[model samples]
Target: MGSLGSRIQGSSRGAEEASEGSCAGTGHGCDCRKRKRSSPCQCDSEAEEEDSLLNTPRRKKLKSTSKYIYQTLFLNGENSDIQICALGQEWNLHKVYLCQSGYFSSMFSGSWKESSMTTIELEIPDQNIDTEALQVAFGSLYRDDVLIKPSRVISILAAACMLQLDGLIQQCGETMKETISVKTVCSYYSSAGMYGLDSVTKKCLEWLLNNLMTHQNVELMKELGVAVMEQLVQSSDLFVMQVEMDVYTALKKWMFLQLCPSWNGPIKQLLNDADSWICKRRTELGEEEAFLSTEQGAPFTPVFRQVRLQYIINDLASARILERDNILPHDWLSAVYKLQWFAMLRTEHDNDTGPQEANKEEFDLNSMRCGRKLAKDGDYCWRWTGFNFGFDLLVTYTNRFIVFKRNTLSQPCGGSVSLQPRRHIAYRLRLASFDSSGKLVCSRSTGYQLLTLEKDQEYVVMNLDSRLLAFPLYVCCNFLYTSPASGRRADAPEPESSAHSVS
Candidate 1:
């Protein structure tokens, strides 16, 4: 019985050792020994199959979570709520909840729910960003209350245009058009022509051209004038024609009435042809004349003449004189003689008075009596006749001849007076000076007239010369002096000469 018990105990220990060895190899007790000896350990296969099944589904779920986190955190943050509307029905409630809750929190440490709620409080829905808003914005900007810069304004305008805000777009367009100068507008048009803003550029061009035309800045227009003309011509041939017609009408009316020159047949034909061309172009473009003047036979009042003259004077002053020493005869005459002649003619036409009494006065070479005495100190009183178109001949003691015109004469009466040649003369006279004691030491006519000599005051002749003939004078004074007899002065001083001459 002791021998049998020992065998049983050793067999039990052997079984335990085998079990430990099998467990070390397969991590499970070997079942092949209990079953058929041909069967291998099937437990390893079963364990591997179970692990594959479990890990496959878990790996897929993990990948899906990663994708959700990437889209929610990286992609969704870049898009606004309005953009998200494009996702369609694929954006289910479960997906949204997962994205806003789990994936958003995991990736960004925040949820869309909180962000949406915060943004909703600040945003106003259905706010019309039209003219009213633009007006308010512009008013604030104009008053310098707004801090937005020009570049930012452009950006806002682009956004407004893209969003189909018509009033805001138009307002911005107009503002941009008005604020940009012609030079800058041209530059921008050339360089930034491909920015999908051709309409804005066109508006800017139109505004600049319109303002230039209205202001009539001819010199400025001439400087950049060709470009504007080209633009207008290209826009609508009719527009060019209409502008030409208006210009022709204005020029024709001015030539006939204000300029004192009749419109010749050739000039009329040229103007008519210009008008017809303009009309034809306009008709093709279905456009009407913009500048419609009411008066046809009205006089031309050159409001811009002063401005034009100033520009011309400045230009002339700055330019180099081609022939300084000896000026051309025509140039000198144009500058001096022609203007004097015109002034003389204008005076004659304006005055309605008769010629001065020629044979009335007593002439003393030493003591001359004027038809109307302007000044008399003791024995000699300087006298002058009224201004006249015809020349008055005065003979003195020496070989001196004085030619006076009607325009140079002064009316003894006080009122508005015109410098008619019949009343005045373009003459330079020499006046003789006397001592305070009324002693005439010598007789002469100074090249310059003494301004202190009153209309009726008399001064002893000091000097005289023929060089005075070279000087040209325009009679501009309207003051008239009379003798004590109320008769017009015959020998009034010649009209003062200006330092500069105009044509």
Candidate 2:
């Protein structure tokens, strides 16, 4: 019995080996070598061997936690429990992910009707919120990070704000802050204000303050509204070119563009065209009253009020331009003239040597803003026009150093210089250089400081690195040569009008 069992086992083992070898075509038991390559027997053997190579399944990498959730849950909507209908589109969303949003969380958790409903319809009233924005806003709930283009930030911000997605809103603010430029600054400012993003709003304002005069653009001017212009004009930080008169000129061009948005012309001709347009309008209206007093110019009265007429009227040529343009009311210029006369008398006789202390409030609101553009790296010595309370300030850029000299006697100056033993002036010095796209390449500021200078005294305000200096650099300085004892000059009258200006 034992011998018979051994024989059977041996026979079974041989049979198994023979079958394996025949299928593999690697043993004498196989006849595939003699068969034609295209024959079914050889093909079958080859197929068996090929199938064996891939018999074990390939192992695929698992999706990441965030990606898996975003794809399977947000995009694919594989196991969605809620249907969101908005902007003529539908989203199969999960309540767990929807709970991440304050808007949806409130609807689902509160006693609202949507809490019990499977299909909820959303009403979107914000024009900035569109379907594409909604898609990004929704996908953000399922993903760890989102890619937002600067162009689409406004719309996404609107959607995120509507949906009360704090994270997405913050991300949008960061993106807007990082991408601020001449083109998007105005829109971003308005949108940031609308969306309650004060940081972005402040960032936009800084960009505008730095570039408004340094890099003037016709389109940017057209986009600036009255409120924004008022803030910029009133700010002591405004970078003025040459003198206060240029600021007025820029405002004139900006106002003209604001009125005539369709007028597309080169920047060099903007001033001439604006002047011609105003002249024609004055002729057509047949009125000698200042444009700000008329119905057409009344809307811009606030913006014009922010202009330091006292500084502009100090220059004879600037005063003549103001009178000729008739854009400002006669009463406005008359009051400024009277104020200047009194200021001049005080400075000349009363021994008033500018501000005694640094009153930042007084300096910011009333400082004389002036700037100069350095076309190249070289020695530059110049002074802005107009009498600055006998503080004839001279700015010098030499050897990569900016020096301020109280021009009392060292050099011959066009304007009168104070001979006081000591004079105090609160000033903020800002230097900036821009690229071709009007983006700041390098910048520095002295913030706001009070400096004391005696006759012929010189102070080095800035020491710059030669390598950091760029051509066409702009140097903006705000100087407060005088500050009131307390409140605004009580004698100076505040004017009010009851009309609107369109142009």
Candidate 3:
């Protein structure tokens, strides 16, 4: 029985070896089968064991595959009792990695874990903290169609900077700059200065100063105007100072002209001094000054004259008031007319005479009506009728149905007529065939009545058939008659009358 059992075991081992050799693609001389029976199977068994271990669970494979390591930061000295539970009820604490603090010593943290989940929690001491509520607040801030206040933007910027959120910091900075006004910019300057954010402070200051210079005005600049000026002066910011100083000088000149016209000499002197100071300062700082200079080599003569004329007009207008009911003084009228002439001359170079000379002729022609002979050197001869009767002296270039009238004092001339160059007719004159008298009369024409003049009064009338003719008059001193054959229809409506005197 013992021999039979040994034979059977040997037979079984041989059968196993034969099967292994066949599997190795060798009948009986395979090296795997020739190796020691124990070790030969042990190698295959160890490899199978490893394969089974690899296929056992995917969690171990994932752990071995992932090589990323996250760094953690504890902000605000780590005394913060940051509650992990506040992140979310579903937050798994096993995967948490990174954290940071809020700006105001408040506890805030962010964590990342497996399954592609991230959790953020904020802890404010002495306050009821709700993660959803905090999220809603931030969501409202970033939501479209929400009008976010500038203050809120500033707060967000501060918080984003503290959290090391570079993209959020940049976004908030741009928004703050866009909505910040000069007043708010000033306030922000103070706040940013206190925060040791030198870069942010500098950028904000630049924007504020630029905006202030753009809209530089007395009323607007009055708030912190002195401070702004001092800063520009001390910093030697020539461009900013130039803009501000130009606006300041213009406003000063305007106010002075409006408020003190009688003190012309003093005002002019002050303006010159200020202008000189600006020029000198500009030259010292290597900047170009734009102002009128009496010195040599100045290139802006026209601009200087324009500015001077403007000042003169402003002064004159400020000093005088036009009263619709009160009569203007003769001297004041002459002065105003003179100023107007000067303004015209400055604006237009077509006139050869000065404003005073032009105004003298205009005033004399308007004051009284009289005829003057054309001299050999004169350009044109002027013939006018004297002022008399309720109907003043009206003159026209030629005879037309329409008549020109002027306002005059009442007269006693009922029949007497005055002619140019001292010819006075006591009887009314009439028009007959355009002749000097009734010599070439074609037919008898009806004539209008004329007013009789007293000894010192003057009346004008046309003489034809020795009848006086009067018609409605217009106030235009200079008139051009339009002929009926020249497409001028008498039946057409007249133009609207103007209030200005004609000259």
TM-score of each: 0.19, 0.82, 0.24
lDDT to native, each model: 0.33, 0.85, 0.34
Candidate 2 overall lDDT versus native: 0.85
lDDT of 1 at 189: 45
Model 2 RMSD in angstroms: 13.3
Q: Model 1, range 1-503, lDDT digits (tens) per residue?
A: 56998999999999897764454456565655566535555875777888899878442334455555445543444332311111121111222332322323343345645444322221212233333333333223112223333334454454343334445445555555545553345443432343346676775565443333222222233234333444532221111111222322333232233222332344345445434544454354343221121132112223211111111111232112212211112233235334334434333432323222222121111011112111322222122332222323222222333322222245445433443222211122323322332222233332312122212233333333545322111111111121111132322323434112211
Better of 1 and 3 by lDDT: 3
Please write out the lDDT profile of model 3 over residues 1-503, one tens digit for every residue: 57998999999999887776534432334356566655656446656797899889664434322222111112211222222334343222222222322331232222323224334354443122244433323332222223435656555555455444445555655655565555566655655664445665676555543333333433333334334334432321112212222333443343333333343344337556444544454465342322223232133232222211211222333223222111122344345446444433322222111111123223222122111211122122122332121123343323322222332333456432222112111111112121221112232222222233232343333322223322211111111111111132323332435111111
lDDT top scorer = 2
Model 1 root-mean-square deviation? 32.9
What lDDT is reached at residue 105 by model 1? 34
User: Distance (Å) between predicted and true CA of 253, model 3?
Assistant: 13
